[model samples]
Structures are given as C-alpha cells and as structure tokens.
Target: MKDWNEKCAVVGIYNAYNASILSYYSLFSMQHRGQEASGISSSNGEKISTYKNSGLVTKVFDENTLKKLQGNSSIGHNRYSTAGEDSIDDCQPIFAKYSLGELAIVHNGNLTNAKKVRKNLIEDGAIFQSHLDTENLIHLIAKSHKHQLVDRITDAINQIEGAYALIFLSRTKMFAVRDKYGLRPLSLGKITNPDGSVGYIVASETCAFDLIGAEYVRDVEPGEMLVFEGAYSKHITMPKSIKIFAANPKPCIFEYVYFARPDSKVFGRNVYEIRKKMGIELAKEHKIKADMVIPVPDSGVAAAIGYSRESGIPFELGIIRNHYVGRTFIEPTQSARELKVKLKLNPIAEIIEGKEIIIIDDSIVRGTTSKQIIKILRQAGAKKIHLFISSPPTISPCYYGVDTPDKSQLICANHSIEEVRDFIGADSLAFLSLQGLKNSIQNAGEEKFCQACFDENYIEDLQE
Candidate 1:
C-alpha cells in the first residue's frame, strides 16, 4: 500500500437559532477529517452569510465571525485537498446565483469524472469559478431541467462518477444526497431547540452528532436523497435501486483506518473500536516483541491501545503532539513541512529511553512523515522501533473524495513491505490484512462495505 493524503468532511443544519454555534461544533468534531481549511455558511431567512479561511476550525471562525453570521440554517465544511490547491476561493460552501435562486453547497468525496463534466459544461457556456470538482456539480444543476430542484439535482448527480455525499442549501430548503455506491459516509440526525422547534443535522460522520447533542439517526442510504424543509423531512429513493456493485464494492477503507475521528461511528462500526482491533490484528500478524507500544498522537491512540492489549505490551504516551500546529503540508516548501512535523511532535526521552517501542499509526501514505517520526524516536535513544499500520496497504489511488496521489507518486504501490520498512528505518512493519480489516467491521452487518482503495476494484461503472 502507498501513502496518499485526501480527505474532507461536511455538516448541514436546519431550524436552529444558533446555527453558527451548531455548525462550529459539528466542524470541530470533524476536525480530524481535515486540518487545512474550515468554512461555514448560514441562512438568516433573507440572505446567506459565510465565513471561511485557510486554517483549522477554531482558527478560521471565532466568536466575532459567528456573531456576524446570523442565520437559522447553516452548512459547514472541513477540507483536506483531494483536488485543487489550498486557497480562499477553493474553500467550501461555494455560492452561486441562478434562475432557481441562490445556493450554497458543501460536499465530501471526489468525482472521478469531474474533468470530463467540467469540459462539457464549459462548452455549454458555463464559466467555472474554482478548480474544485464541487463547482462542476453546481453548474450541472444549473444546466439541468429546472422543473423541480430535486429532479435537477438527480439529473446532475446521475452524470457524476465516483464518491460524493453532498449537502445543498437553497433559500427555502436544505437537501443531502449520497452516491449510489456509498463510497463515503453521510448521516442524518435531529435536535430540539429551546423554543421547542426541531432542528435537522447532516454530517459526514456520527461524531458530529455528539457535539450538538443531536441523536444518531440512520446513515443516509447509499443512492438516497434526503430533503429537509423547515419542519418536515423527505427521502428520495435511488433512481436505480442497487447496493453493492457485483464487480467491486470499494468504500474508501481509509475512512475507517485514519481519516475519520475515533469517536465517529462509520458504516455502523465504531471507528475507535475498529482501529483498536486493527492494532490487535497487526500485533497478531507481526508477533514482534517490544517493551512499549506508543501511538503517533491522536489518530494512532486507539490502535496502539489495541496492540498493547493484544500483544501484552505496556502502552505509554511517549510521543506528544502539539494540537495547535497549522497545516504542515501547505508549508510552501519541503523544508517547512519537515520543520513543522518536528515542532508538532516531540518524543519524550524519559519515557522512550532504553525502550523497544512499537509505534502504531493508521496508514503510511508517502513514508516521509513516518521516516521523520522513526528518526526522532531513534535520536531519543529508543533501542528498537516497530511500525504497525491499521489498514492494509493503499496500493491503488482513490478516485473518491480522498486526496491520494497519482500512481507514480504512491511510494508503497511501487515498493514491497520490506522495502517500506527499510525506507522508514523501522525494525519491522506490518499492515492489517484485507480480510482482517473486513472482519473488524463485521459487527456493522452483512451488507457490503467498500474496500476499493485497498483492492483497486472500483464498484461504480465508469462508463455511466
């Protein structure tokens, strides 16, 4: 598997007086999905107000910004660049004006056919405002038959290929749709406001529901369209009723492995539990003798715990992460990224000294970060270092919303496990098997799950 970095999350809400507060909370819960940028849009019955910037959620929006956004309905986004550069225009809740009225859209997942769609739209006199694939969706809707908003949305979605879970906001209504394959995750929930009016919330993961005290509703059915009016909700069935593609059902496995917050319940499986099980499985497969199991801060904590429990190794927080670090990947230069990683993570020599440490991380996309971490540990006097990845190798690039590199850029896709281990300077390296990864999520039910990024089997028909 290779190390590819692409990810984002979206949250939408309706009928809440403090819509900005709820939006902030939801985005805060999904902060792990993306650290590069955060944006939010709120509708105050008359107009829509938005606030977005190139930074983490808290950094982008503050009390002053929230106070300025007066609206009863809102949509928010957290982004990690899968496509397009990190810039202000690329920030989400993209707005546009058309005959149907104004719309603000925030989307999760990528469209494999985005380039083709954009080309076609451009030929038809549509001017693109940004490089994001999401902009194509808005134009598609504008050009479609405008008999009804949902009908237009359905037609636009039918032309899109790859993973997507989108929340569309119109002047009077808020709607959400998930791709037929369910390549990404989307869920719906409801909350009660002080005035006794009910509020509707939609988010990429269940963790967002916890922040605003919204109850967990069922996941948005793959290929399902959900419409939330002021006080009512409606479900639109898929035009073509289908579940798993017989050829392949590849949901981005990374969502379960690294991208989602540990507290999230994705595909009905608790992310923390699944990650821990991956660690346990990795330990079982590798059987390495180590003095202590240490995690790479937040994302690896669960898996490290699992590895410790399964391997009977003591767990220690030998590496501390500074939560305040900004986006290192967007540091503008290689040296900047290296320096940022060092500033963000520091190995506690007192805890790691003389210890044979097993470091658990969700995945290794490029091997650069892993190499740096291992170097830090060795420099801190760790006798030996072992690396355990929770998910199987990401051999294939993701066409879905995730931001994986092209085939030429994926280091693991071109290298063997031993090669990757040697490259990272780890004494040993092991990844969870595909079957074991599936087994970890078996509690979620027998319905199929997408493992395309691990398997290279795209379930959606490219031709369609």
Candidate 2:
C-alpha cells in the first residue's frame, strides 16, 4: 500500500523434468516481487518457446499453457516495469531469434546505461519492438561478433551498468548473472529429482526455492555468472562459475526493510530475524509511554512484535487488512480516496477505543497514506497515536530497481520531523536511526549494503 514498488522477479530452472512447472511455481512463490506481468520461456534442447502476458502469475498462465511449454530447461519472470511502459509488449522472458541460435532472457533490475546503449543500437539501424530496457540486452547479444554464447554474454555485460540479476536461456543451456554491485538479489539452489538426478535453480528470492522443494545453496556472488549445460530431461551437474567483474557488493538494504518475504533468507541473513531486530532497535531508540503496541497490518506485524517483546508492551492487531482487496480503482475525489484506504484497512474499536497506542509501520512515502491511517485511528476513538517507522526516513530517490518518486515527492525529504508529525496528525513521529538499521542487520562479516535511499550516495551517475 506504501509507494515503494519492487522492480521484478526472475527464476531459472535447468535440467528438470518439469522445468516449466517448476518455473511456474517459483514465480507464484515470488509473486510479491512483481504483479504487473508474468511470463516463462522453456527450451527443449533444440527449440525455445515463450509465453507471456500482462497480469498476475495465476491469471496469466494455466494448465493448457504450461503443457504447451514442454521442455527440460526454462527461465521465468514477473515484471513491475521500472524501465518500460505497462503493456503486453513489455512483458518479460523476452525471446528472440539471433545468430547464436535462440535465447530467452529475464531480468530483475534497472540498467543505468540502457538509454545510451539503445540510442547507439538505434543509430546502427536496430529496430526496436518493446520499450523494456531488457530488450537492449537481446540486441547486444545478437549483434556481438563473439563466436560463442558465453563470450557474447560477456561482451554484452561489459556494455551495461547498474543493477541487474539476469537469467539467459538458450536452446541447450541456462546462465545466471549478477551485476558487480549486487544492487538486486538472486540466489542459487539445487533440486534433487525423484529419480536421484540433480537440477539447478536460481531465483530473485530464496522463498521461490521453498515452494519447489529446492535446497538452498548460497547466493550468487556479485560480478559472477553461472553457466548451466547438460543433456536434456532432468540430468545436469553443478554450474560453471565465471568471474566477470571485480566484486563491489552493495545489495539493497530495502529488501530487509520491505521487499523480501519474512521467511526468506536474503544476503546471508533471514528477513524475519532482521525485522524483529529492527523492532527491538526501534524500542531501544524511542522511549515511549503507551498502553499497547500496534502494527499497520502485514509488513508492520513483525517489527511490532519485536517492539512489544523488547518493551514489555502488549501487542494488538488494531488495524485489519482486507486480503482480497485486489483490483484498485481510481480515486479522484477526497471521499473516494478515504474509501480506497478504508476498503483495505479498518480499525477495531473494541481494542483501540480510548487507548494510547504506539503504531509501527515500515516507511512513509508521500505522507497521505500515513495521514489516512492516523485519521482512521482517531475516528476509532483512540486516545493518542504514536507513529514509528522501522527504517530511517527515506530522503532520496532510488536509481537502482526500487520504484520511488523524486525527492520533491518524498515527504521526509522536504519536511521536518515535527512538521511531518503534525501533517500526519500523530502525537509523535519517529524513525529508526541509521545506526539502528545497521544494528538490526546483525552483520558478522564485512558485508556492506546500499543505503542510497536513506543517504544519498550513488555509486553510478544519476542522469539528468
């Protein structure tokens, strides 16, 4: 419900008997990453077939379509369009015929150099079909003079910059690659078939592996590529790793704060544990007096629990979210806007009436949603609302994959904390300190993460 949107999810299955089925299930598991479109492309050793549409995974693919995509290797994607127009033509698993035979590609992050490369490609007489920056890759691979697919991929990799977790599927092999900075996430896993044969899977999140019964191996390292090749039909060995670029890992910190599923392990840590720790850190940072601790439903639940545990305050689900509030309508009027939020969340007067409550949420974007939430609690007869966020106030725009508005639109970027507190109608408002966020991570190694959204430090150029 907040403004930040995940860019996409990519899953690749190799040497599995039901590669298409496994891909479908993995995409379904990671559907939280993207909802605008879903697609899969399968390769049966000699040929590659692709199917894509603009909708949720379940709505886009069915038994009939899955049966038609018969193959032993496949790659799939769920897209939220950070770099493309919202159209069927922009749906992913972009398949094409090229000099290196045929291949399909799925990508999970935005490319910073796409416009320059696309313009160069266009000047060289390349005709474009889709608005997706991912299409820029297809052209790069197709036009490369390298004799082999891997070499062509390396050539293309050299031409692109910024965040990307990409999966490339050919007529016989599959390749998974992560950018030098690891701005987005992608994990590698192993799947043991019923016949004792081994297959491979790589996905945007480890949660995708859980649904398909794949064993979690480890994260694909930054600037690394895994090349998968073997005979068709559920028989494959471990992938060949190639170090393409020197590692400079700066994985997005927002994955722990919002994008990832709580149960999944991202960047060598469990998201749920980190979130609970964030709540604990929040309790330590903010000294509050309240009757109860409450969550804003869904994303705020875990941190609220941690806050309650740390502060010895009772926790309550004061706000209930409608799980089936699927399709959204345009709200042109003020009344309609309130109705839209009310349709998703309504307060429980029995628990909240005349009670001083501490409400926890992930982050505030434009401040309108937070204002509406506080308004609803006021109407429910709550005595006071103390609003807290688990992460540092988002002050800058994200240039990697996360969908955020410009600095002018981010409320915290423009307004003071006191001003924001008054705007949202909260008695008090506080955000977790940047150090608190670092403490929640529980990092034991030298693992550094991208906090560009919290602190403006762009490793790449931000174009005008």
Candidate 3:
C-alpha cells in the first residue's frame, strides 16, 4: 500500500445486557486494528442509539456515554482511514433512518466499486453523509426489492467487488456477512451469562473472543450471512450460482505476516506460529554471521524469536517501542510520520554498541520507515545491521480490503533488492520466498490463504 493505514475491526453483540460494556471491551481488544476512531450503536428493543467520534476508544467513550447507550443488542467499530479521510463524520456504526426503520452498519475492508456505486446512488436521489463504503451498502440494501434482510444483503453484496466483513444492526436482528473470497477475517462466538441468558459475539479476529470470555464457534463462511434473532440464530450461504468476479483468492498476506495479533488465529492458522516459521525459513534463505538477533519491536518480535531459535543466535531487545504513538497515517504530513517513528522507537546503545545485529520485520512497504530505522541503528554504534523481511516483496498493489497504493507506489516495485538494501543502509537484505511463506503456514490448512500481494496470482478478476 502507498503508506496507507490499515482498517479497523467490526464487532457485534446479541441478547446481552450492558451491551455497551461489551462493545467497549471488544473495541479495546481490537485497538491495534485501528486507532483513528471508535464507535458503538445499540438497540434496546424500542429505539436505536449511536455514539461515535474521531479518537481512540479510551478517549472517545466514558461511563456516561456507555450508560446512555442502553441496549440489548449492539455493534461497535474501530476505524482506520479507508474510503474516507480521517474525520469525525467518517467514524463508523454509521446510522441511516429511512421509511423502513433505522439501520446501523460497521464494516471492515474496502469496496472496490464504491465510487461507481456512490455515483449511481447519487443519481437515484440517495444523498450521502459520509465517504464510507458502508453507507453505499446501506443505500443498496434499502433500495433492493427483496424483503428479507438477508436476501437484500445478498443482493447488495453481489454488486460489491472487494473485501468486506460487515455487521448490520436492524430494529430487532443483528446480521454479519463475509465476502465471497473471505479476504478479511470474521468469526462467531458466544458467551453465557449467569442470568439465564446467552450472548453472541462477532469480531474480526479470535483474540476478541478471548477478551470477552467467549468461545469461538466457527469462522463466518465465505459468501455467507448470519442473522441472530436474540434467542435464535440463522445462517444463509449464497448459492454458488451467484456470479462473483472470481480472481485468485488473494487474502491480504500481510495479515499472517504482520497485521494480526500474535495470539489470534486467521483462517484456522495461528499467527504467532506462522510468523515464527517464516523466520526459520528466512534464516535458511540467507545465513548471516550475527552476534545477536533483534526484532524491530512489536510486529517483528515473533519472527525475531524464530530467527534466533533457528540460527542459534541469541535474541535481545535491542530496540524499544513507545506504545503510546497513535496511528501513523493519521499524522497530517510526512514529516509528522518521520518524527513520530523516531519518537516512538529508540535503539539501545548498550545492547548494540559493538554487536553485529540481524533486524527482522514483517514487510517494507515504502522503505521510508525502514530507512529511518536503519539510520537509528547505525547511529547507535551497531557494527552491522542485516535486515530480513518475513514475507516476499510486495510488488503489486492490493485490490482487496487492504488499501494499497498503485503498483508504481510500491518502493520495492521501483527498486531492486540491492537498491533497497543500499537505500536502507543495511549490510545485507533478504525476503522470505513464496514457498517459504506457504511453508510457514503449513498448519494453516492445505488450502492457501491470499498471497496475491506477493505473487500476482489472483483467483478473481480484480479489474472487473
């Protein structure tokens, strides 16, 4: 992606009291997914209430706001800029009131045909209040002739071209749907309360399941719609007859390598284990004589551990990251991003002053951040810094939910491996092979996840 930020998480809860608290907890667990904004929409049998703002979850909501959102069924969202610029109006759980009642929707992933859809909707007299793709979905569903909400949703989804894992809140029932290719991760789980009532949760990742004391039931099947009716649940899988643009199912490979939390499982694969194996394979590709292996903080920690274990090199926390930095993309300018990264990360001079270090990271998007990081290590008196990427170079842009820039925007696409190494000022640099990446996720089931960003083998026609 052209230095674009990642999108947020969509969470929905059903048949539970203190739904606002559950929303708070779910959004908090997914804070890493998006830090730009947080929102919640709840229904208390009679009316729907919503509160959303452009800020971190902690800063956006308080006890009074939670108390005000009294409802038994609710949906929450954490946002990173995707279709819209970073503004409070773009914060989600976007609600639209129409003749058929009110609907609130939270979405994760991007809609490839959103611009076209928006123009069509506008021509048909539908006014837009925000730049989110979810609003387009709401309008599509509202305009569909189908009466059943699931049928209308299916109809609307057939027109959308990219990835989406959505949670829709109607007057009574809550619905969750995943894209046909299953590009984004969504799962269903349930929690049992002591008051003889049950609660159902839908989140972007399984880690959210653990936080809410919910047991994961199953992943939302591709091209499936799930409806929870407070006491009963129903599922509908779109018929295979539906003509979907079939590109190779290139789920964002970055999710396995970096974006997902280590503890979470994506597409039946454990992220931590997959990342560790990537490191092992990376070590095999480029053997380096390093005194110690150091990860570039949080995202690289799992791979660094794996590299150390495989190469028999000691692992050290040579760099520390400040957790307080908000989303880097939200900064108004490039200079701000540079300054934030410097402030957020500092090298340990004592640990790397005279050491030959191997720095492991997930991927290098634009190479700007990596360059600065390497500069920091060099200034810290490191003898040598060899950089290893856990995944293959991202040459093509992502057309799925991920907000990747045009192919020309990818630094690696414009520069050779040696050029990138020189630009980053690393002694040596290597990326995990495509085969190595697939091998790393051996436990992730025989069917491949999406590797289109690295390998231009898409299962579906993206240009359509």
lDDT of each: 0.81, 0.92, 0.82
Residues 210-314, model 3: lDDT tens digits: 987888888777776777774323232221222233433345667887778899977777889888999999988878898999998888889899999999999
Q: Which regions of candidate 3 fall more than 4 Å away from where they truly are? A: 1-4, 232-250, 326-339, 444-446
Q: Give the distance in Å from residue 19's predicted Cα in candidate 3 to where it truly belongs.
A: 1.2
lDDT of 2 by residue, 1-464 (tens): 38899879999999888999999999999999999999999988899999999899999999999998988899999998787788899999998999779989999988888899999999999989999888999999999999999999999999998799999999999999999988899999999888888898999999999999999999999999999997564446789999999999889999999999999999878999999999999999997889999999899999999999999999999999998888766656878778888999999999999999999999998999999999999999999999999999999988788788989999999999999999999999999998899899976356788898899877754332
The Cα error of candidate 1 at residue 188, in Å, is 0.8
Q: List the candidates ranked by TM-score, beginning with the highest.
A: 2, 3, 1
Q: What is the lDDT of residue 54 in candidate 2?
A: 89
**Residues 1-464, candidate 1, lDDT per residue (tens digit)?**
22445578899988777887899999999887787889988887667788889888988988999999887789999988888877888999898877787889998888888889899999999898788999998898888876888778878888888788899887667888877777788888887788776778889999899988998867877777777664323222222222322323345567778777788888667888888888888778778788899999978899899889988999999999997764444645867656767888999999999989989888877788898899989999999998888888877776677667776666678899999999989998888898777767746456566666677776646422
For this target, which candidate reaches the highest TM-score against the unseen true structure? Answer: 2
Worst 10 residues of 2 by lDDT: 455-464
RMSD of each: 3.7, 1.3, 3.5
Model 2 / residue 11 / CA error / Å: 0.3
